[model samples]
Target: MKWLEGFQKLSSVLFILTFQGANCQLAVFPIGPALVNALAGSNVTLAVSFRGAPDPVLTWFKGNLPVGTWTLNSSSPPDIADGSRDVLRIENNGSLTFKGVPKHFSGNYTVELTKSGLGQALVTFTLKIFESIQNVTLSTQPDFAQEGAERFTLQYTMLQGVVEQEIWYFNGGKLKNSTRYLIKGRSLVILEPTRTDKGSYSVLLMNPFSSVTTHRNVTVLYGPDEPIVEALPAQPFYKVGDSLVFSCQAEGFPKPTAEWVFMGQILSDFHQGVLNLTNVQTSQGGVYTCSVLNGLTEEKREKNVTLNVYGM
Candidate 1:
């Protein structure tokens, strides 16, 4: 089996809704444009034209990433547009649309055709984005203002029916126009958070019609405590009949692990690092320490306790 790519100007073939057969042709209008910029919560429309193709399958690309294709169920919502704005009709039409949009969704797009039985054609459009005045945005991503050292990616999205002229914002400020980012639908992405970005931000719907806003307060948090282990028996004294219960505890992102310790050694003798002595005897007494460890982060902790042995 061999592959072939025979190009006659382009490779897309178009089929008229009617039976045009091999005479169908594909044409791209607005062959070139600087960009197709839009505000968040806005729909972007592409102007195009097609002709002369037996079967045309639409493929869409943004920047270099494939947004999706317009074949079979080729439906993609624009920026932040409601589902109503995403379908492209007229097998010969050039208008490809992005429904509602988000800040990071701005870029260049190309609507291409893969005509197996005919030819191919590609229409490229550049897209730019701005804060939308249409809807109040909610930052659904976790509030990670805490853990100043850990990097976190936060996400925000806009709802429908916002005042389209109002100023929308994030991270306590408007997104800088020059930042290189990706806007996928009505979603705003914060690549990584830093110390300077710890604060509250809101989406402001400002216009002569009506004004409203949605805000989110972000705060960083830290620390629970080191894990410490101790024997339930009296310190420096344990009787033969006493119940010997060992307790372990720690703190971290996942509430650090607590493990039983005996004679300065961790005891994973139990299925899950748990070790318990049903009854203590004068023969069992020593310095025990709980070892807390998270191998992934290379974080470990240890705290010790001591007990003495006595006859029952």
Candidate 2:
């Protein structure tokens, strides 16, 4: 009886202590996390196990506000004024169930179990309700950026959900906030985007109930570096019937287009950036221009090579 008396004075605590007397016993044990997470519009159960008086009365509360109660062997729960009467259900084993949890119902929940002869036992739980993430899409402003540009932005949007965390990845590696990178609520910005930044980028959005990941391939347009024109023969003058080979090389993101101009006319046959002239003649000696153009960045560059032919 001393243990029963001491139990009666037990203050409100989370699964504080369990007691068992000769004929009467009371034990409340949690089966899951004390902090429960549920999705809005989804059926959720806050479960617990109890060993107490056969005709125990169980009452539920939200913080200091009384929620509802369930009498032993009762089919329906006793309602107070919480409006949970429509969705909340008390199970036979003293567990609470929400037919479809509401986002606004997230808060601390407590359960009180008592009987006439025995003391009261209390268990507390923290409930969190979140909306499911759906229709997630990742995109970049302008879809492409030029190298050395001030900045580029990547953003993601979701149809519904409360994001607890935002994570970004670049080229399969985790991205950290740095001088070159900025993370906002739903966007990521990269300063001075370079060719190295042209790769796969992904973002992860998470919540209590669900998480989603979206990916996009970002493009960073760079150049057509200064073109270089090379000739096979190093001599300034060429002899008739001699073989001459000219090649133009350049570097760029989209592979710059090379055009060979001879005598102010585009040489259609030498569009591949190489010109082959065999059996060189005195009339064929002039200046050759190799023009390199980058369609993406609109960058143009050119190199010139001169040939002088003499008859021996």
- lDDT winner: 2
Which residue runs does candidate 2 get wrong by more than 4 Å? Answer: 1-36, 42-99, 104-127
Residue range with the least summed lDDT across 10 consecutive positions in model 1: 76-85
Report residue 266 deviation for candidate 2 (angstroms): 2.3
How many residue pairs collide in each prediction?
40, 0
Candidate 1 segments exceeding 4 Å error: 1-132, 135-212, 215-221, 228-230, 251-253, 263-265, 268-275, 281-283, 293-299, 310-312
- TM of each candidate vs. truth: 0.35, 0.64
Instruction: Write the residue-wise lDDT of candidate 2 on 1-312 in tens digits.
Output: 998877766743323443225445676777889998888888988898888667578888889988877786876656545677778887778788888888898999998988876788889999888998899999888768778789999999888887878899999898888998999878899998988898999998899668899999988888888898988877778998898888898988889999999999988767469888889888889899999999978989998889889888
Which residue pairs does candidate 2 place in steric collision?
none
Q: What is candidate 1's lDDT per residue for 1-312, written digit by digit as tens?
A: 123443432334432424455456665567446466566666667766666563357666767765555542336422322332343232334356656766566667777776665667887777666653445556645555334343443344445443434343656567532342233444444444443454665655543335667777655433335775555543556667676666776655444556666765657654333457766776667777767765434467877777666774
